[model samples]
Target: MGESSWAIDLEKQITTAEVDEEEIKRWVIDLEKNMEEEEMKTSRSIFKVPTQTTLLHKNAYEPNIVSFGPYHYGKSHLQLMETHKKKAVDYFLKNYGKPLNNYVKALEEVDQELRDSYENLDDEWKHREKFLKLMMFDGCFMLKILYEYKETLAKPGSENHDHFNFDPQLCLYIRRDMLMIENQLPLLGLVTLAAVQTGKSTVLFVLSFCYFLKLESNSKNSPYSNYINSTVFAEHTGVLNLPILIMDEITEISFLNLMAFERKAKGMGSAVSSFLAFMGSLINSEEDARFLRSKGIIQSTLGNDKAIVDCIKLLGKDMYFNPHSEMCLTQYRLNQYYLNSIKSWNKRLRDWSSNFMQTYVKNPWTLISLMVAGFVLSLTVTQTYYSIHKPK
Candidate 1:
């Protein structure tokens, strides 16, 4: 609802998804697997051939990504997770007042109230909370911000943050793709910190990719960011940076489209079809998916020619994708897909209607089971609601 105010003084925020217990168990098992594999840094396959140049050579000149957002907003949290703060001396000294070996001993001497906040946790989030509190002591965000703006952290006479001065020219690539390039830094990233709700959290999660890119691009000259570094000095940049922003919000989209598509059927179709068509093209034609697959363009995968054509078609026919040859295949594909949507999925298409997920979920057997569950839940909720609102 609101950003977490330090003034409120709480341990954990006490908010979580209401996913089923089975889901929680699955989530924990995944976490364990992730943790167990955290130390892994290399892999190889029999089919893999020796490269003339490592990825470092190819990505050296790639554009860097930047978050272009506000403060708190879990920027630091995301940075720490990606950077792995627990692996270094600077992080150790910065996080716990004493060095790693003696920090716990010092903690033992501290006040019990303070100890409770740090030691009372039984899970990873509690550890995160304890870490965040430690951040307050030496400028919680300075390390991360400086790390991203590593050019600042690398200036000849760089001292604590105040001495840090960012090199404007070092950003040779504007990264017009997904990285937020600006005349100045903006505050969208910080305001989004409180987005724990499904809708907001989902959007916030997408922005983390942007943040990750920014850190990658900016960490070129960071003294401490050398986990990926190869130079004695900040010699080369962007080797670790991925110059892409691909939002495949597949899970979120299914529900959103159902709402928009339903509204369009009720005579709102014209008003909403453009958006539907664009999204449909975006997914089906697969611009990001194809680009990602080019292997040469990004990571290896097969290209989605349909998505490429659909995206080009959206730019309109007059602006032919190849004006010299006057190619307009994309426009034709757009027309074809839209026509297909209408011909195949419309209410008049009985065959299509029969195959829809809604039809499957609403079948007689499913209807009967849903009705029984609904009746039971209705009684339970009604009894509780009635009791709560009664004469009192």
Candidate 2:
């Protein structure tokens, strides 16, 4: 009877072990599948902004008036530009001086390359014909917009503005939308179209857009170094620099997209994040933004200084500061300089002088009174000294 009881317990333990082994196998299979999917997705460059980021500023990452890629292709609000896209196709064909089929063929050749550019392209765009159409239209429209932008830059106030029938405000919205991360069309598609159009290399055409945005590699020197002038940093003795930032309506969108790309793209450097974080440190309030604006360090086309402050704060939020980055190390150095300055007598004198001027000198009359009073005190001191030493 004891042997039979022991045999039953051993059978139960064997059954439990088999069940656990099966469960472990299932978990391993699921993890492998998930990892495979993630690995596939990771190769794409363009991506939807993370939900947490969009929740912070939904409009910053979304297209408003025009849709470019598959992400925002069919939104109702952006549908108004569909007709303009057709117009853009017409203009692009004419400007290319080629048959429509030539450009279409060019795009068809790179269809797979374009599809691979997007991380989460929808099934609706899976059909080769549909996807090719999207690439052609969006690419042509983007090319048209960029050409018009170049023309506008070359001839700033010439009444000849061809915006594919979009009014000025809508055109501005298109520009802003183009800077969004998810609203990006593949560069390969654009380059193909441009090459087909110009019958030449795409370098010059691509450089036009780069030049428009002034996208340049950052220097190792201080970002605040004012190559043009150091007048803004005149008050400071040791550090002779001030940041030169140009803030416009699209500045926020440009910065947010660039930072998002940096965050998403593996091996991509964090220059944008670093610069924005540094700016965020400098701009704690509207007053700081306004002071920079007044000193010409910040040139804002936005409505107010507060908008600039809010935008910088928004960009700088949720950023990871890489301690080894140039900007981060520079910030550390600046902080140390500030701390040392606080301990120095020269800084204290400057601070006192600034406080006295702000507190006591309300106007020219107050300054004049202080100067006269100082003169009187000096005269009395002189007289007292002479009186104390008379003929002795």
lDDT of each: 0.34, 0.76
**Per-residue lDDT of model 2, residues 193-249, tens digit only:** 888888875754444445334333223243222222222332245553554667787
Lowest lDDT block of 10, candidate 1:
41-50
Evaluated at residue 392, the lDDT of candidate 1 is: 54
**Candidate 1 on 1-392: residue-level lDDT in tens?**
87678734443344433548998899999998887444221110001111331132332212233322121224442342222323333543654455443433333333232322221123543453353334232221323343444444367554454322334432323222122111112122222222211124223333433333332223444432231222111113212222222322121222222222233232322212332233344434455546544633223211445544443343222121222211123334445666766875666678666665476466788777877999999999999998999975
lDDT of 2 at 307: 89
Off by over 4 Å in 2: 1-43, 161-163, 204-237, 240-243, 346-392
